[model samples]
Target: MNLVALAARCRAEHDYNPLCDAIPYVRFLGISVSEEAGEFISQLAFRPRNIGNPALPALHGGVVGAFLETTAILELVWAQETLMIPKIINITIDYLRPAGPVTTYARGTITKRGRRIANVTVEAWQGDRSRPVAIAHCHFLLELTP
Candidate 1:
């Protein structure tokens, strides 16, 4: 199925499994989404394969980055009812602390939105939401269906 149809199905069903399953990397990363208080929260289930530093036992920087980006994308889709996938213009990630070997949660907020573009900020936390492991600012080009 096309992304537009897949996203519609996800919204109608209030489940993101099919949407995540459509993306191989997202499925491999064990990313899932849930609604909390009318907001979307994304989770990344910890896995041994995601460890970048075996000694420090930290999640790979790339994995964390991907998780943040995915969260942003999902939020955009949910918030705007996007008809197509948002194309990334750019992303800047700040690693605040090492992501411990634990499930990570992320929330993306739309900082700004225009007819053709959107700015999103995402924060990922391992245990304490107050102490974020990483934060990301992302810009995406939205392609709305007419």
Candidate 2:
């Protein structure tokens, strides 16, 4: 779905900005959706600043995990009729390369969906899409109501 249509749909169906509410800490980054592209229908962009880095100067692992989860769950939030807030069941991340101090983009896809569970895969990239800096596979627990 288009970005504006998606936003309206979120407000109509999910009651508020699912993107912002779900990923509040990353809201200042102004991360929004790009067009539907191939396997992934939406995208999120984040450039790790000095503050987001670890003591040793590497991108914080928690940020990577949050980015991946937000991107994946959002895709589902937009696609499904009844909004479901996904819980983290499990996540496996592979850091192919250290996230550099550049604009990093993330794309995610739902690999499998069950009654109350879903599997999602995500990749974060900078400059190169084919060679992602980090990749993640997550098992999600989705519940429709609070």
**Top TM-score prediction, candidate number:** 1
Error of 1 at 110 (Å): 0.6
Could you give candidate 2's per-residue lDDT for residues 1-146 as a string of tens digits?
44445545665664435555445564754455544343433334445452256554566676666677777766666556225556778988888887765566787777888888888888888788898888899888877664
Q: How does each model score on TM-score? A: 0.97, 0.71
Off by over 4 Å in 1: none
Q: What are the clashing pairs of model 1?
A: none
Q: How many clashes would you count in candidate 1?
A: 0
Residue pairs with backbone atoms closer than 3 Å in model 2 (clashes) = none
What RMSD, rounded to one decimal, does every model reach?
1.0, 5.2
Instruction: Give the count of colliding residue pairs in each prediction.
Output: 0, 0
